[model samples]
Target chain A: MDNIAGHKSSLTWAVHISVALLVLLWLLPTLGLLVSSFRTADQIAGSGWWAAPFPQEESLQLRTAGPDEMTQDGDLYVIEGNLLEQNGAGDLDISAWGTSARDVSAYAPGKTAEMRGGETMTLEEDGTYRLTSAEAFEGRGERVFVSATVPPEFTLDNYERILFSDDSREGMAKAFFNTLTVTIPATIIPILIAAFAAYALAWMDFPGRALLVAAVVALLVVPLQLALIPLLRLHLSIGIGKGYMGVWLAHTAFGMPLAVYLLRNYMVGLPKDIIENAKVDGATDFQIFTRIVLPLSFPALASFAIFQFLWTWNDLLVALVFLIDASGQTTVMTRQIVELLGTRGGNWEILATAAFVSISVPLVVFFAMQRYLVRGLLAGSVK
Target chain B: MNPALQGVIIVVLAVAVCVGYFWSSNQILDRVIFPAKGEKAGQNINRANMVRPWLFLFPALLVLGVYLAYPVVETLRLSLTQRVGSGYEFVGFDNYVQMWNEPKFREALLNNMLWLVVVPAASTAFGLLAAQLTDRIGWGAVAKSLIFMPMAISFVGAAVIWKLVYDARPLGQDQIGILNAIYLGLGGDAPQTWLTIPFWNNFFLMAVLVWIQTGFAMVILSAALRGIPEETVEAAIVDGAGPLRVFFQIKVPQIMGTILVVWTTITVIVLKIFDIVYAMTNGQFETQVLANYMYDKLFRANDWGVGSAGAMVIMLLVTPILVWNVYNARKEMR
Candidate 1:
């Protein structure tokens, strides 16, 4: 209100710098993971993601083509080949060369290292190597150690392997589809059920409405841990064991409290005149709800839909208890990522890519509909 | 049938069932049971109107009761008994006694207390700072969105992101984790295994939550800050209050209720803090929280009695908040 007196340029600069620092602090972990997801496994293992944009100096153990591919030149048994291609890293530059790991990188490119038997070997900066021996070549090619500078490299190969590869254990394609299956119905069913309940609680005068509303509010915080065994037992006894239908039902129940609470709060705030006018026009309560109230409650509905969608998509506990069984046929992305974390703990490439794949959809939804999401959050919390 | 195709069919069938139930029930209420054009049209209409709310409420309450309400009681019962061969044997207080003696349970309880105290305070403090700083600047929205972006990520995904951040490499190798990178850059001798350190690793896991929750606290508190009346702030400034003074002495007291709301909301979430701990450390290295501890007992150890007892501990912890919420709700209704 009065920036005239208190606003200092230094303080403003401090605020700016502080905010930037905080923002970077908050964003760095995710940025690191996102950057790592696109990097090759070797690159990730060799350097941090901060150093990803620069050439990474790595000591690679490479070999030339075996003696079978060698051709004699000038009565010399010769093996000429690109060491990088032979080692499966074709896009790196040989910075230095050596014949032994102890003195790896001792010889510069275009330099020759003397052999014990009056033979010689020279490595070019472009990874071309020539090995000249006086006698016939042996069964195996010479082992060479090359200090190569791998340029900044990024690839969709990580995503491709995680998302589209045929390796059943590594692929996330099934889990992605399974998450969508669990999320859509779970999101849609609850909103529909909650809308009708919300309308009744908001507008219609029924006995025990206040108590019912209080119950919903109280249920909002009940930890789903309580529901796991009992509900699973219920589902099992009712012949709806660990499966899709069971998960959908469990998610719906778990999400109902917030749905009814949020929608009721929003519905209660609507202009009273329009609803009264609609009712006075000889329209039934159903007509009024379907026409006037439902349309008017669009923001609240959208808000809860996003909430429920995000909740169900990211949920693991409910799905673990009610959906997944020993068969492991239907695993959602979050659960799948956890399993990957256990089995593939050291494989950052797979972990990061799988996580980003799981995180991407919600991030898109979050940014696209943040206005509604924020509105829902405020309404849900403020009341 | 293809699972994707099955999903599509289930979605379609679910929507159809819900819509059909609503339409047919309402139609039955109006046309068959209580015809509004009959001789006692007004009485018939009153009867139908009385029943219509239940018609709307039936499915919700039924589902909530079966799926939420009854489970609480059942879980309570399950905690009081042990499962025999094919049936359950009632063994009152034995499970709780078992849980009390288990060192892991005590460890989980203590860690949860630590989490409960630290996460909300840190998140709310940082959120208040962020809200205050970002409220006036030009690029504040951008800054806010970046801070808030973590809210969208799944706990498992965040676990991965942070796991990478806290990743430790050998001293000679390049440190992939930025934390270790920064540590080594700052003249530290060797890289620290951030998550493997016993007592401090709890803070490391809690850092992920505080990171995610700080944005939420910021958004809510920012709104509350905006809703602070301009006149009070102007009067405070006119009376010679500085920026920090005005924020604390004037704006803060007014918005304490919203702050508490955000605090308790985060508290509720922290009480059930399983996913991050489960995904990151799996309660290893003395970082066990109650929810994850419960999951371990129930799922891994195959002991539902002790698991239900653990769940009851969570419920008992939340009972006060639940009662307070219901009371406030009733008061608001009145």
Candidate 2:
């Protein structure tokens, strides 16, 4: 008994390790993209996102006032001012100043320079300096090095552009709405149709009942691409080609087989006693399906709805093949993101924000409806 | 009774009922479906009936028939005909013959074969592993949800995500793609097009499908794994089977049926896959599969005979699996 308990704990540990690794593997890229999306273009161009958040030293050129600003006061030509802004841009003290590029930042901002011919110069912290030279300011611009602390600044600009701007040919906002239009109906239609079909297949007794279910399963093998052109031809013939309606129909057609198969499996797994009781109460097939099966099959419907919605929402091929046009009215999130990659591929913020926008809906759907997915899948599998 | 008269009467009745139902339902559509003025019926009171089912089903079936079923038949017919624009002359099995002989079709067929074998197996294995691992952990639900999150992202979406991971840059630029960066970080030379590599590129492309589908397999397998009676495992413990042995010997056999179902389901999906290949690489770089091949032939090249022939080949290839699924489903029903 002790050995058995020991073995079980060891097994649990093993499971934990493996699960942790799998979750990490799944998360790494998405996290990377998310992080990269928030970074500025120059930062992204300069280093990997993994290198972000670390401090590094950088060189910059600074300038001080020339000898012209110098005044002959008392004995010394004193420069009185601050080298940095006190309130807004901040008090970054000047490290050094010099005349040549090589000797830039050689002297502190407040240091007075003693020239060979009794010439003098002084620089203060407020970027003002007095160069008390017997001669007027005749030299080139003064160069300086100031150690300025660059803070990590994040922007919502990428998101703003992806969501609001029309500059990107493949902006995610249009695609997002396009995906929504395609997915909402695609998700709802399949569930609606599949619910009825699932009911009829699960509970309704009719001639050729098994055959209809079999046909749907057969359809599970019919790859949409194989039907793409033919379907398009049929769509054009029927005048529903190349639009939201066409893509919706395409998704529904593609989505139906699984939806029916899944919902039917879930519906069939439902306790027979409830369905039997409904039938005995003189409820017709349709009534029992609506009143009894649908509500009880909420787990399955919701689960399937989530799956369909996500797929349709994330779909690009169906949209590309059927919905996309030059007018850009039918552009979807996936297509827009793809176009962004092609055009603004270097723009991490645009790409990541666009990606996030595209996935945001699915994320919500998954999180909110995830429990039903587990319940629905288990409901179909357990019994 | 007159048989012809009875047939006519039945047709007349079906048409009359349909017309009456439509005319009445137009008024009720806003009331029931759209629900104006907050008069919508609640769950208990709102009822669907025999007539309502047909009404709900009509538009769907019509759309399916026009867009789906009609094209399916038209594809089959188009396989036998040679098309010149909108018109076609029947050419019989010549298209089929030509497709069988075409080198590109053969290559696509082989790529699909690789996709079918590798993708489903790898996905199932990973999913099963993940499911097994998650089942023992305290945070199993969260872990499973995270892994399953990709399933919600569409094929094109996954491709988009992978594109960033596989984005290749020439030397001297910041590497955006992780894999290429790794190679370059290791002091490698130029970035290679991963999706464009021949034969093996198929497996690389298959990895995308595996990633997207692993969630599906994990979810289904996780459910199936949960359904494995705890009593059985406990009983196996009394027999002294180690954890690994117990998993293989007891748990695996118990859920074998579900595994086969999951594997086959993904197999069917893999067979129909055109989106990932189309979206990521457009079937270039020796990654072309049968479906995309069909699209190119039909849409790009305008070779109706070859396209139809390719479609037929896919249909034939997929039929056996479809039959197997149907058989299993029927058996499960029993």
Candidate 3:
């Protein structure tokens, strides 16, 4: 689209800026979740994820070491500690400090606050604090409030808790495995089934082949909500029941139309010369399909596999209906994330981590096989 | 056995069985049932060819019919019948009547209409914009993939992502949600809980769909735009058509068919959009769409009659597209 007139149209910069903005808009949400998953619960609640890379300025409440650590020095009992050092936020720089909640941040760092019991507490910007009194400090210690700017922190603890937790109910490991269990068979079986059907429709001389193809196209847009009740009843009555078998069958059935549609579309485009030459060589239709056409239709098959994998893996409704039971044993990642959303709505650490775990596989597949995905989209929508 | 090990074994076994079924059936037809050798060898071969396509198509056809085709009819039947004790009695139109009377269903229908209008149009417009703009830039493919990235993320995942965007905290606290922070930053009096606000929240929900689907629209429309006749575009520009004029008048008109395809494709997606509504709002706060409504009737309320009726409504809405598609396929066949 470069200007042949060589006038250097001003629209180019406008286009560049617009695309930059669009890319950022598209990337920010997932970026936020990815950042949040590496943060702790307190960090998420304290500030928005957009501030993740910057230093966090927060107010902290800390206590000096107990009266047991006190010593008499020149007619005074004293306790000394660094609030930031004790809390392990040694990177933090205190901006303000105070001795009571009512007067939080009443003084700048290094100022001393006079207590009612004739005790004096002095805090410095480096978080070092001194507690001195004529009598030894009582109970715990003098409470001090510090408003400080702490350096950014990130952690792998969220992943550890979600993936390696002892309780199966809390961890994502089982659901992750269950999702894989549903996805792999659902992907592979449909390709073989759809490929054979596609080969038949594409090359075979048969009555009603066109009608079957049209029916597949019609079935392409049939919303699966209509399949819910009837299929559930079928599952229960036939004793397929809500588990791995039932969900796999449901996924296969649901994925069949597009599988056949995409594969047949690609297969039909396969040159007539090859199939006819194979037939002329005395190869069976089965041989022609498996030997020549199956290998030839790799792109279409790959496209469908990725589609079925993502659909069956990310599926919540189908899993909810046919796979997941009241026992929560057959739960998949999507279902687990939804459950987290319900029970741990405010727990962004868990929600973000589980959501990320659920989406990460699809994202990996998506980026890796994106070419096939896009090609499938273009081919599938051609008609 | 450990559950993971059990899952792995089942996966292995299932794959083996499916493969075995395909291979053994074809092997049986060839080796045992109709071996292409005999006194009537040609006859056997001819018979074998006739039976073989069905063998190829049988598994897929069986699944399509039993899983997809039967459900359309069965769901239709359930809609007209009321459940009795261990049986169903035919009561035509009663279920539809009950479903129609519910305020929630009405709200759902209204909201689905809103979605149908907004999501496809907004997605298409933005997609066209992205497609056109990116082509004029050097880093278009990189930008397009980033836009298309959301298509891979599940709807539940998207709901979680957007929930954070629409998240709100009370005033006088550091607002955690991006929208809230922006709202407060822009000097809005209070942070709006975007999802809970009525009348406008639907747009917030729709924005998530828009954000996700714009990539799809962009990808399809970008291809369509690339497929445009360069000569025609050149001729348009030769006549002093401005850039916008060339776009709206020339480029868009040529790709109108693809645009319609993108629109209809997204329309189908919008109709079946369940996870977003289910996860974010659960159809509360006047955000009920028909799919969620049907789910509510079937699962939560345990009303099969009305649930089936709701399903039929969605089916009815889709019938026109099905007919159009079948008609198109038949036309293409001829």
Candidate 4:
């Protein structure tokens, strides 16, 4: 029995190790991207974002006041000042300091320097400096360089550039709104239609109901790509052409099968007793659906909404066929990110920040309503 | 009129009003849905039954029919027509013949075959493995959730994240892509385009979907694993079967139905796998599957006839799988 327990413990360890490794493997790249987003382009180009904090040392040229303020004592003229203010934007870990670009960081940050022919320089923590020279100070400049420890801090700079700056080739702000315009209506329209259909299919008891369900199930296997051209041509023929409205309609069309399937499944899982009771009370099918089914189906609706919203939000193919206008006005966030990757792919900061922006809403919604999703997926489990 | 007749008439009137409202709401919804639920209320018969289903089904069925069903039928009809420059001419199975001969179409078919065989198998295998392993440990739920987190990521978003990891620069350059970096770190020469390598690239791309789906597999398999009656396991133990033998001999057969269901569900998604391939490689370098191939010919190349043929072929390839799935689902129901 002791041996048996020991064997089980060993097996348990093996499982724990594998799970940990899997989680790390899955998370590392995303974590790398998140870290990379806060880094400068040069650092990103140089090393993995994981190494961002320690290896990231920067040097900037700074100037200090020269010998005019130096009081002549015997033959000594000295000049000293710290070039970096408390608010210096450059990031570096200070090991040394220097008075020349070639010899940058030659001295420590607090170290005083003695020059030849009666000159000395000193720098303080507050970035103040004192200089003394016996000889009159001439036109040559005083250079002060210091290095300091730079902690990793996230910045909104990438978001600023991607969202507002004209320099961005794929301006996310416009595309973001475009995606919302496409996604919201696309999600809403399908759910609205699917709910009514679901109510009819699940509770209303109609002929061909099984056929409709089977047809829907079959349609689920129909690749959207197969329908893109014909659908586009149909759109063009109908004068809706390629635009927001066209894309919205396309998404709604694509979204409907799953919407109806999911909603029907959820509605069917609903207690038949409640629906039947409503009917016996003469509440009417529509009233029963609206007042009882709709409210009870909230979790399912939210789950499907999350699903539809994410799909429509992330859709590029439908938009590519129907919304890919030369004008930048109709571009969605996914398309914008794709183009950005093509052009500014090297900029992890921009890529990560942009990705986070695109996914933030979905992430929030998922976390907030994850319980609904879990229950919805297993709606018929006990049955 | 009697009270029953009056009630029936009122219900019929209500259904008519709902159907009429659906018709006028949007043209897309009207054509798809009104036909499904719409029948004019009879003047003589009682209205309760006629109006009841129609009033309940009108809005939902209308939206589905217009957006989903109509497009499906229209796609089928359009598949038979040849588009020359700007106009379509009916061309029957010529498109089908063309699709059969198209090299890209063949590659797409092969790639899809690879996807169907690989993704579900790998996902189920790993998920089952993880589930079994985690069940031994206590932290299985958290581990499963962590793995499943990727499923929450949108396809395009996942593509974006992976693109950063697979980033390639010139030879002797610092590798930004994780795989390339590891390769370089092992004293190897510069970057390789992971997404652009044919044949193997399918596996690489399949890995993404697998990553996203394994969590789903783990969840279902975990439940199924838990569902094995402890009494059965105890009986197996009493028969002197080791844990491994008991798991294989006792637990597996009991949960075989769930395994197939999960496999089939994922198989359906894999059959329509255009997004991952499109987002990652745009189906370049032998990475093109049927869905992407269909999209290219249909939307990019504007070869409506061939594209439709491809679509039909996809439907054909998937039908057997669907039939098997329905059969399994029915068995499970029983």
Which candidate tops lDDT?
1
Each predicted complex: what DockQ? 0.82, 0.24, 0.72, 0.29
Kindly list the per-residue Cα lDDT of model 1 for residues A254-312, writing each as its tens digit: 99999999999999999999989988888888899888999999999999999999889
DockQ of prediction 3: 0.72
Residues A44-64, candidate 4: write the lDDT tens digits: 776666667675444555666
Deviating ranges (above 4 Å) for candidate 3:
A5-9, A116-118, A133-135, A167-170, B31-35
Candidate 2 clashing pairs?
A82-A125, A82-A126, A82-A127, A83-A125, A83-A126, A83-A127, A84-A125, A175-A332, A175-A333
For model 3 the local lDDT of residue B89 reads 97
lDDT of 2: 0.71
User: What does candidate 1's lDDT look like per residue over B189-274, in tens digits?
Assistant: 99999998999999999999999999999999999999999999988888888888999999999999999899899999999989
Model 4 misplaced regions, further than 4 Å = A1-6, A57-153, A166-168, A379-383, B1-47, B136-138, B169-174, B187-191, B326-334
Report the C-alpha lDDT of model 3 over B1-334, residue by residue, as the tens digit.
6655665776677668767877898889877888878787788778878898898889889999999999999999999999899889999999999889999999999999999999999999999999999887778889999999999999999999998888888888788788889888988999889999987999999999999899989988899999988998888778777788889999999899888889988999899989999999999999999999999999998889899999999988888888988887789778
Q: Which has the greatest TM-score?
A: 1
Model 2 C-alpha lDDT per residue in residues B63-150, reported as the tens digit of each score: 5565556767878888898866668888889888888787878888988998988999999999998888887767888898899888
Write down the lDDT that model 1 would get: 0.91
Candidate closer to the true structure by lDDT (higher is better), 1 or 4: 1
TM-score of each: 0.97, 0.78, 0.96, 0.80
lDDT of 3 at B230: 92
Model 1 residue runs over 4 Å out of place are A73-75, A81-93, A101-103, A114-119
Question: Residue B151 of model 3: what lDDT?
Answer: 90
Q: Model 3's CAPRI class?
A: medium
